[model samples]
Target: MTPQYMNISYHDLLKATSGFSSENVIGTGGFGVVYKGIMAVEGIITSVAIKVLNLEQRGASRSFLSECETLRSVRHRNLIKVLSCCSSIDHRGNDFKAVVFEYMPNGSLEEWLHPKESMNSQPFESLSIMQRLNIAIDVAAALGYLHEHGPVPVVHCDLKPSNILLDNEMIAHVGDFGLARFLIRQANISSPSMTSASGIKGSIGYIPPEYGFGSQASTEGDIYSYGILLLETFTGVSPTDERFTDVSSLHSHVKMAFPSRVLDVVDSKMFLERQCPGTKTVCAPKSAHDCLVSVLQCGIQCSKESPRERGTMKQVVRELDSARMLLLR
Candidate 1:
């Protein structure tokens, strides 16, 4: 069942975000800016992430509506929670639209994957092999949920690390539905709503090859993206890394070194943490390396160029579970 939508007044949103100041800004993308704010709800102070739409940008309004409609019906532990929304007019009488969500303290998976130099010149700790496994499963479960429900399977057109948020407990939650689409199986393809107007395939490097050729988005495309994200999580490389040339990508980069020199592509710091155990990140058993190999194999399979060749989310979920089981043993 779709959760009840909470309607927030524009004045309350302005107050919650402190006039939408730059200091409170937590994230920004094609849609708009997300601000971390404290708002009193039912006489209790609460932390919330307010995503204020940039109406000046094309499709910003559509993104808001798409997110609202999609998230309204779906609920999952691995999915970002939508607390409320403000769709009223601003003080200037201009159009105003914003969404309020549960504030994720750990920010995005992108931040943790590629940590910036901190104030003290130290980078944030990398995610452990176990943590990566769990995060991958979390994401997979969310994607599977989206594809399994309703009259049609929902395809998250845009899937990337930046869109995956982590909470205070390090639990991963998928966010940002600006480019979400509902696959209309009647025509055996994603609705033209995605391609007709803007021809948006997806973020560079993360886009499936089929989508580039005007193929409608599908569950297979979402799986392909998940494969790239999974590879990046293990290798600590971004799909958009500058080193990839026209003939190569993160998938190819990892493939070239797989089985023989898998560790070469694996994040050096992360490998050390996994191997050393108590030094930095949490430690798993010795089978961790072998488990990662199998996990990478699953990623390679899901990211296959041919949509027919890609495994279903059900298979991907099972393989990830097996990998995690191996790590524990």
Candidate 2:
């Protein structure tokens, strides 16, 4: 059943976003522009992020409907909460559509992972190993819920770091369901090579190899993206890094030095060394090393070239949790 949305007028959104001022713009994407707004909800003043659809772009209207359809049925703590959506006309009477979401104060995971180095920006702190581990598990948990426990299984066709938002508590919330698809047919869900042939699938570098061959969006495809996300999170190396030459993707780059030379590829800012409790001088690097290796291996397994070989989101969650345990120990 689709959840009933709060009816909101276009004027209200315009006012809340200060006439959709350029200053209120928070982010931009293919579908539309996102604005940070302050609005009244249930008699309480609330901060919201409003995504106004371009509508002029082909598939933009479809993306809006897809997002609304997918978000209506799926509810998870790690998933971004949608307050409401508007399917109305602008002042000029042109078709206008927008979706309202809970404002994430900390912005996106992408900002934290790769902060902009500008003199005008404030100094940003790098995420600790513990924090990164927690984030990894948080994202996996969301995907696991979507793929296995939702009313209808969902395929988050776009699963890049930019789509992952961070709340006040720094908890990761997977957002941007514009390209999501519901696995309604059992055959499509079961077959690894099922091809739906959508015009465009997902972001470059994050898209699975099978998707390039016109494979339908599947849980396995999500797993592949998650694997690349996991690898990038720990190594601080994006899948599209300049260092990756032809035939040398992030999967292969990490595979080359996985167990033995993981530290060499690991982000220098991340402090993985944990000292044993009650010992001021004795550090347990080996335990942390082993835990890192486990996490990276899981990433490798998830990003395998063959769609059938990638691990499920459930398996990825288990592996990441175990790695967290190792790190804590």
**TM-scores, all models, native as reference:** 0.90, 0.91
Which digits, one per residue and each the tens of the lDDT, describe model 1 over residues 54-78?
9999889999998888788678899
**C-alpha lDDT values of all predictions:** 0.82, 0.86
Across 82-159, the per-residue lDDT of candidate 2 in tens digits comes to 999999989998999999999998887777778872211335578888788888999999999998899988889899
Clashing pairs in 2: none
**Backbone-clash count (model 2):** 0
Kindly provide the TM-score of model 1 when superposed on the true structure, using C-alpha atoms.
0.90
Q: RMSD per prediction, one decimal? A: 3.6, 3.8
TM-score of 2: 0.91
